[model samples]
Target: MGADLIVEVALRHDRSEWSRIVPELCGGDAELEALVRALLAHYDRPDSPLPEGPYPVTLGPFTLDRELGAGAHGKVYLARRASLDGFVALKLLRPGPGMSEFVEQVRREAGRARRIPSAHVVPVFDAGRIEGGPFYVEMAVCADPDEESPGSIRIGRSLREAQPGLDPGEAARLVEDLARAVHAAHRTGIVHGDVKPENVLLTPETHRVMLADFGIATSLAVSVAPESAPIGTVAYMAPEQWRDRRAPSPSSDVYTLGGTLYFLLSGVAPHAGREVGADAPPRPLPASVPPRLREIVQRALAPRPEDRPASAAALADELRRFRALEPTWHDRRSVSRRVLLFARRHARELAAVAVVLALLLPLFVAGYRFFAGRVGELAAGEARLHGRIQTLDRSRADLERDVARLEGAAESKQKELARTESRLQQLPRLEQALGAAKEEAARSEAALAQRDAEAREAALRVAALEAQVAAVREALADAQSRERAAREDGATREAVARQDAGRALGERDEARRRLSDAEARLRTLERELRERDAALAVARAAEREALRRAAALAPAPGTK
Candidate 1:
């Protein structure tokens, strides 16, 4: 019988009842009976301590609900706090002879976590030893009611479960929060020796991330001797962390954070090596990840501690800037690269500006020409007015001369009349001459009035022309201003386009390099595959030859 079926049957009966029924179930087969008995013995063992099976109903102030997860150190359970209304994670330490150190470690973790007081760090509630049983610690549950528990899901699961992957910005933000928590611990002289995705907790409802499990954390102030083997997950540990056999520092945390980010982005650790080389290139990130972010991750994962960010806080700052699309320290270091990235990011805006400038170009030229034409017309009108003013002045001068001559003639006539008064015969002739001179003076006055009217008309025309000229000049200035602005905008667009082109070229070259590397790897794999195929073919032939020889050596069917 199958072990599962035997166990199922065995559970349904009491020990004495099962012992009598097992032989009948096995049907006198010794092997089957022995197998059933072995399975029964495992099920009936008094000290199995199965995490998913029977357990005490309560531990101190908490009532156990169900098992969340189990590890070598302990089994965590979803439990209701007797004193509180909310659910908490109750981790019950395994019972062992040398478990005092583990219990002390749990207490230390609780104390360290409580002291930090950061939202990103999971809070610890209480720790105590259950009477005649395992040691347990109650901590805040890091999960939502409808979502998978934090212990059930890890970074790899989060990535794999989602189609494609998490959004790059969201992943970066999550890691940034994690780094901030680590930084907070570092500031308090606490190093989270174990920094990996499995130890990071995520709240599904709030999407808030918290760093969990500081069991291996060490304080810099305390002079604890280094262990023979390095602590922390091997995949994320720094090279110096292992080679130097030293306690983890802020830099070690930084490396693991980078590895976490790498896993978030690419769904794999940066490298598999327990102690990666300083010069080893990090696994390439996906094309979706921004180059700046990828570079930041790579730098943080640098094998040498000194080569990485000085602290987790600095790494968090870089990630924050990346998420905000602001210039980072790396971008600030290279002006051309920064400009190129800016141009590429804002290409659409640049294109819109260029279109606007193009559309305004003809309007600007036409407006300029229209204003220039109006100005020329005003200038011509002004010149005509000046000429008319000169002509009016000449006419007025002529009229003044005639008026003076007429006055002179009238005075001469008056003198002649005075002399003629003595002689009665000359009296009629002087009266006629006076009438003629009077008519001549009236004509001269009319001519002067006409000239003055013409001059006044010319002055009015000049004033209107001056006003039109001023208006045209203002319009011309405005058009010139707009044209200059358009030109400047066009120049800027051109510069941006050139920069974008350069960036595109660089990206194409990068793509080609990657393709070449991929091709080289493909060739190597193909070679290995062909070698395996040949070996497989040779082995099959050798087997056939052996079979032929064996058949030939077999005795003739009837002769033996």
Candidate 2:
């Protein structure tokens, strides 16, 4: 049975009822039963002793130092390779029952991420399986460059965790940088199945974007599981992805990139805490967002995949163009000022053009008079020139329309700047509140650490008690066995003693009977001797007697 079933059973039932629960889930597999028990043991008490093997132990060439994070399938550890100089992130698939496929998944994650050679993508260094252990991938650790300390390691934080509420322009630039990285992945024939704020990492000082977590990366040509549940974050998922209708493509990544931008601008995801609707329109951006940026985001978050940007590269290009025009949008100069500046900057060129026109004026008059007689022949040429002038007029009108739109945008930008300044005015108060929150968080962390230490100690005590109880149980079992054997031995000895006593009694009775008969015979012989003496006495009295009887008895004795 799968370990998931065992875990589910353990969680669903009361802890006291696991005795009845896990055995059934294990299906009589002793190893599975023990494994689930160990898993639950560790789950309940992290400090509890593990089975025969655990991490912080060596796997192949890397010695796992500590667990950095864990997910359903595996754990990431900060590890040091024996032959390597720096630390690497080692992602190892957790070994358990029914996890054979997960091993291949980890291998594929490493393979796909390793193939995309982009600075924005976390580089995979190596991947292998430990003999009789687990599969692991070694990759470069993304750490905060700002927090770097000599002879110490720094862990990187994801963009959402580290920095939120970015300015609209910064958000656009960040997403643009990441889009280029996504484009690079697509070029390498890999589609990052999951792209959200969490997957994007930013180096603190430089704000460098590092797109990570290719664990769910799929082929650019087709999705590996198109009919499955949406493979990406729901808030940023494209409509087609939500429907699971087709393979995730570069356009899907662009859609998520737009969602990321939306989040940065509004401090909330585009569709946070909601399911994707079949006919949902793109959410309107905040008023503070520039029209150009909003347009870009809305286009990327199009309901139909085809309606969105064709590729991540195209999305990046749009953002690039927006950034290029951003300065002009922020410029507060009126149209008149721009015209005057243009004129001032080109005065020399304008003077040269005027001098050329002056030199050509007389020639033009002479030519017009000379050609007056041929005016009928030049009618077709004049009509062509008139058509060209009309086209130029239309072009000038279009330019005027563009200028008016830009003027409106510039006014909106000024209002946005005012709002920004007003927010900046409250910075000190916000900083104070932030300081208070950090202090409270520090206190909470300290309290939590104490509680954690106490919990660990309690776990140790409980484990000790359990060990003692087990020892007592074993001793009780041994004593009971000894007691049973002793009772059996005593009963056998009693039975033999009874048999011997009965035989001795019978022999004694026989001896007593024989003695009684011999005594009876002796008594009878005595009586006969006495009677013969009495008769001899009576015969002796008739004559001279008693003496005679005695003499007769003596003579008889002599004759005999």
Candidate 3:
């Protein structure tokens, strides 16, 4: 079975429901059941393949390179427009039946989103449907181009995946930015049906969150039949959306923004791990979240849309208020810090005022004594004046000493200032030298990088040579084994040949001995015959010498 069915099911149903839903749909078909099991094993993997149609090489002026991400209705591609050096995200709706409404809604809402005056919203460049093909939207890629080379494509990581459990202040700031984007859309009568973390993309360098798939989700919600299943992400969908009780509104967007914030603050969705009924209370946020922010999120996640923020703008304002407390209301300095800062700003002026007050205090006392003398206590006034004079003299002496001490300190400070000025004068030369040093370091680093590259090349060559050597060793061992086997065979053959030769030699010796014995027997028989012939001749010589010749003649005649 093809994975298109599995991919469709995965895109449609929640993963938590796959266990029951897959078997129920498969209905005992082993192939689909096994495929579903395999898909479930790694469906959520980033590298999992979604069985989409063959990718188009070029759509209009855009040359498609590779897919960045996929969704229920469409897939986004990292593509290059004609003759452009930069890249843009090209979203193409999967060509199928019953998608014309979605295509129209997307074209309309994306146009509206294009007019939105918010920097946080991903900008749309163009959108149109082919006469007999898929609908397409060209938009600014919500990522830094430098993140991936021109040779490859990368989707910006979602907010939840990139920076889960963010600081409360950071979470608030991000949600506030999202709310502002939503508010911008709301102004144009476009309600973002889905505002989950997956729709929020973060730039690689600045990590600035930008809302993506702005009109796409709303288009999906509008185009999808209400009797089928509710639209939007379940984890962050508003209660009204879950119940299909009403159409998407700015308040529903506010609820999703709150859910996104909750996910950021606690690394989990507002519903926690499980889906909640429309009547059920939302799960509490993590305790570590700031109380004020928790309250803000809770209000945004309210089950009743009417009880939530009046609009996305209102939600943004609440988030702004919570964020303001981070750096303003709760960040106020203590009284002591305020005084210290005030003194630091007016140090010289305060010193002068203190000195003037100290000097005038003596004059004020003297004036009082003089007035008393005029008032008829002349003797007492005179004594008091003398005492006052003495006290004034003592105070004057103390003041003089303090002045002298201060003067010495001031002189030391002046010397220090002179030294600092002398150092300041060397700054230019130091900076020049520093610049030279930095240039030299950069050159050295470049050289080192080159050397490292060469070293890596050499290492790779060495590894290749080592692999060749290993192969050669294996071949040599095989050849050696063959040679050894050949040698053993040769030895066995030689031993057999030697044994055969020995047996042949023994047989020849025995035959030669038997022949000699036969020859001896023949010779013995010949000698015996000769002896008998001689005995017969001796016997006949006496009595039948004359008869021997006649008998021999007669026997010859008879035989003839």
* Model 2 Cα lDDT, one tens digit per residue, 125-191: 7655554345566778877543446677567667687545478778888899999989988888777
Lowest lDDT block of 10, candidate 1: 154-163
TM-score of each: 0.53, 0.46, 0.47
Task: Summarize candidate 1's per-residue lDDT along 1-560 as a digit string, tens digits.
Answer: 55345545666667788878887777888888887676566546556473464644675676787786665556778788777876777877654332334456667777867788468887767666664355576777776555456435322122223314478888889899889988888777677887877667666567778777764334211222234766666677777866776667778889989988888888766656534544254668899888889889989988778889888989999999887666787898988877876877788999999999999999999999999999999999999999999999998998777656544544453443343233334434634543454354345334433443344534444344335434544443443454345445434533443343334333444433543443464354446435544543443344344334333343443442
How many backbone clashes can be found in candidate 1? 0
- Model 3 scores a C-alpha lDDT of 0.65
Whose TM-score is higher: candidate 2's or candidate 3's? Answer: 3
lDDT values, one for every candidate: 0.64, 0.63, 0.65
Whole-structure CA lDDT of model 1: 0.64
Between candidates 1 and 2, the lDDT winner: 1
- What would the TM-score be for candidate 3 when compared with the true structure? 0.47
